[model samples]
Target: MLYEKLLAPLLFRLDAETAHNGALGLLRRANSRPWLQALLAGRDRAPEPRLEQTLCGMRFRNPIGLAAGFDKNGIAAPALAALGFGFITVGSVTPRDGQPGNPRPRLFRDVPNRALWNRLGFNNRGADTLAGVLERQPGLPVPLGISLGKALQTPIDDAFGDYAYSLEKLHPYADFFEICISSPNTLNLRELQEGSRLDNLLTGLVKKADDLARSAGMARRKPLWPKFAPDMPPILRDIALTKCRELLDPAIDAVVMGNTTIDPAFNPDPAKGGYSGPPLFPKARDQVRGAAARLEGRLPLVGNGGIFDGGDAYTMMKESGCPLVQLHSALPYRGPMIARRMVEELLQAMDRNGVRHVSEITISQPSRSSK
Candidate 1:
C-alpha cells in the first residue's frame, strides 16, 4: 500500500528504464549483502509446499517465475529469487558479449494499462559474461532457466550457429534452455519462428545440447523449451505446434507459451515495441488454451503475459491448462512482493476447489473429432 500510494509515484517520476535500473541497482546491492537480503526477504520468500510443482523433469518450489526479460543479463537473479519467485529465468543472452541492443527510451510505461512496451532487442552482456556471473553464485536458490537468442546482425542462415554456440557455452549451468524466436524487436527475428526454419534451429540445438550434456557428465539432458510469440496467427500456431512435436527431440521438454506481443491493439501509441502486462493477458490466455487443446496433455505449457494478481494467474492456469505461469510487467506495478501475493491468491483458489497440487486444475482438451 505504501509503495503504490507513495514510493511508486516517486519511482514512476523517473524515465522507465532509469527507474528500472535504479531498482535493479538497489536489488543488486541488497543481494550482495547477506544481511540486507535477509532483512528484506521476510514472508515473501517463504515457501508453500502445496504450490510446489514438478515440470520439465525438475521440481519448482512454486509455479510463479520471473520471466526472461526481467533480468536480461542474469544480474540480480539471486536477489530476485530472494523475493519469492519459485524460479528465476535470466538472460536472452546472445552468442557474443556487450550487445548495446536498441537505442535508449526502448522501454515505456503505460500507466493507464499497467503495462510496458520494450524494444530492448535481447540486450545483454552476452553468454560468456553471463556464465561467469552464474559461476560466481554457484548455487542459486531456485531453478534457473536460460533464454537464448541470436544476435540482431546475425543473418537468418547463420542463426543456428549463434544459438548453438551460446547453448554449448551455457548448457552446463542451466536447468533448462529456452530458445527465444519471438521478440518483435529484432530484424526478421519472427521469421525464425516459421516452421521449416524453427525445425532446423531446434534440430541443431537439440544435437548441440546432447553433445554438451554428455561431455559435462550431467545425469540427464537439460530441458529445452522454445519461447513463442503470442500474436502468431491461428494457422501458424497450429503449424508451429505440429513442427514442435515432429522436430523437437524427446529430450526436449515443454514449450514456453509466449514472449511479449507486437500487437498494436495493446499499444495504442505509435511505439514499435512489444506490449506486455494486463493488455497482453487475454490474448496470451487464448493462445495458452489453444496450445493446450492442440497438445492434449502431451506437453506442459508455461503461461505468461498480463498476469498481475493471483486470480489472473489461477484463471490463466485453469483456462489455458498451464501448470506453471510467469510474470514480468506485473512486478513493476505491484512491486517485488507480487510473487508472494500471487502464490497466496493461487493457494486460496486451490483451497476453494479442494485441490492440493497445482496440476489438478485442468481444462478439457478438444477432441480430434471436433477439430
Candidate 2:
C-alpha cells in the first residue's frame, strides 16, 4: 500500500529502464544489510497447506516465481529468493561477452493498461560473469532457473553452439534451465522455435545436458524447458509440440508457456518490443492449454504472462493446465507485497477447488478434441 501509493509514483516519473536499474541497485545494496534481509524474510507468509510443489524432480516451497528478464544478469537472485518467490529465474543471459545491449529508452511503461514493452535485447554481463555471481551468492531458499539466449550477433546456424556454451558454464548453478527462443527483439530468433531448427538446437542441448550430468555424477538430468511465443497459430503450435516431442528428450523437463507477445492486439501503443501484462492473459492461457492438450500431459508447463493477481494466476492454472506460473510486470504494478497476496489467494482457490496439493491440479485437463 505504501509503495504503490507513494514510492511507485516517484519511481514512475523516471524513464522505465532507469527506474528499473535504480530499484535493483537499491535492493542489491539493501540486501547487504542483515536487518533488511530479516525484514523481508519476516514479511513472507507462512506456506499454505497445498501450495508446496515438487516438479521436474525438485521441490518448490510455493508456486509463485519471479520470471526471467527481471534479473537479466543474475545479480539479485539472493535478494529475490529471500523475498519469498518459490523460484528466481536469472538471465535470458547471452553467450557473448560484448556489448550490454540497446541504448537507454529501450523499456517503456504503458501505465493505464498495466503493461510493459521492452527491446532491451538480452542485455547481460554474459554467461561467465553470471556463473561467477551464482557461485558467490548464498544459495537460494528455493530453486533457481537460469534462462539462456543466443548471442546478439550469433548466426542462426551457430546459435546451438552459443546456447550450449552458456548451458555448460551455468548448469552447475541452476536448478532448471530455460531456453529463450521467443524474445522478439532478436533478429530471426523466432525461427529457432520452428520444427527443423528447434530439433537441431534441442538435439545439441540435450546431449550437452546429459554429458554434464554424467560428469558431475548427478542422478538426474536438469530440466530443460523452451520458452515460447504466445502468438503461434494452431498449425505452428502443432509443429512446435511435435518438434519438442521428437527432439527434446524426456530429460528435457518442461516448457514455459511463453516469453511475451508480438501480437498488435495486445499492444495498442505501436510499441516496437514485445508487450507483457494483463492484455496478454487470454492468449497466454490459450497457448498453454493448447500445448498441454497436444503434448497430452507429457510435458510440464510453466505458465507466464499477464498474471496480475491470484485470480489471474488461478485462471492460468485451471484453463491452461499449467502446474507452475511466474510473474514479472505485476511486481512493479502491485509491489513486492503482491507475492504474499498471491500466495494467500492461491491457497483460497485450492481450497475452493478441493485440490489437496498444487501439483495434483497441474495438467489435469485433457486436450479438447478438434471438431
Candidate 3:
C-alpha cells in the first residue's frame, strides 16, 4: 500500500534508470538485515506447498522468478530473493570489463500501459565483478541463476568464447546459467540463435561448462537455459529448440522461452527497444506454447515475459504447459510486494481451477501448432 500510494509515484517522477538505481541501493542495504527482508517481503510467509516445484535439481518455492535484467550485476538479489520469488536470475553480464552500455535515457516507462522500453545493451560490471559479489555475498534462499552474454564489441563468430569466460568465472556461484543470445539491445547477438550458429554455441558451451564443473569437483554440472527473444520467427525458434534438444545430454537443461520483445506491434510509441509488461503477455505465452509443442515434453521450458500477477503466472504455465515463469517489467508497477501477491493470487487461481500442484499443470487452451 505504501509503495503503490506513495513510493512508486515518487520513483516514477525520477528518470527510469535513476529510480531503478535508488531502489536497488535501498535493497543492497536491506541485504545485510534479516528483518528488513522480512518486512519488504510483506510478511514472514511460509511457502505454499501447492506452488513449490523442483526443476533441474533446484527447488522452487513458487513458479514466479525475477527475470535477469532486474538484478543485472547481482546488487540486490539476496533481498529480492527474500521477497517470495521462486528464483532470481542475475546478470546478462559480459566477459570483458567496463562495457559502458548505450547512452543515457536507456530505460523508459509507459505507466498507463504498464510497460517498459529499454536498449540498455548488456550493461553491467562484468563477469569478474559479479563473481566477486557472489563470492562475498550470502547465499540466497531461492535458486540463483546467472545470465551470460557476449561483450558488446565481441565478434559474433567468437560469441561462445565470451560466454565461456563468464561461465568459467561464475560457474561456482550459479545453480544455473542463462545463455542470453536473444536480447535485442545487443548488436547482432540474436544471430547466435540461428541454425548452425546456435548448434555450435550450445554444444561448445555445454562441453566447456561440464569441464569446469568437473575440474572443480563440484557436486554436478550447472544447468544452462538459453534466454531467447520473444519475437523470434517460428522457423528460427524451432531450429533453436531442435539444437537444444539434440544437446540435452550434459547440456541445455531448461529454456527461458524469451527475453523482451522488440516487435513494433506491441510498442505504441515506436521506440527502438524491446517492450515488456502486459502488452507482451499474449505473444510471449504463444511463443512458449509453440516451443512446448515442438519440444514434446522432452525438455522443460521456463515461460518468461510480461507476467504481472498470479493469473498471468497460472496462464503462462497452464496455457504453455510450462512448469515455471519469470517476471521483470511488472516489478515497478507491482512494487516490491509483487512476488508475494503473485504467490497468494496464484494459490487463489489454483483453487479456482481445482488444480493442486503446479507441475501437474498442462496446456488448457487450444494452441496454434508451431509453424
Model 3 per-residue lDDT tens digits across residues 252-301: 28878978887877766546488889999889988998998887777778
- Backbone clashes in model 2, listed as residue pairs: none
TM-score of each: 0.94, 0.94, 0.95
- For candidate 2, write residues 199-317 as lDDT tens digits: 88988888899999999999868889888888878789778887776655443377787767888877675455889899888888888788878777766678888898888888888
* lDDT score for residue 102 of model 2: 77
lDDT of model 3 at position 353:
92
Candidate 2 lDDT trough over 10 residues, lowest sum: 362-371
Higher-ranked by TM-score: 2 or 3: 3
List the candidate 1 regions with Cα displacement exceeding 4 Å.
Answer: 38-41, 44-46, 249-252, 362-371
What is the overall TM-score of model 2 with all chains considered together? Answer: 0.94
Write one digit per residue (lDDT tens) for candidate 1, span 208-260: 88788888897667788898889888888878877776655433377788778
Candidate 3, superposed: residue stretches over 4 Å from native? 250-252, 362-371
| lDDT of model number 2 | 0.81
**TM-score for model 3?**
0.95
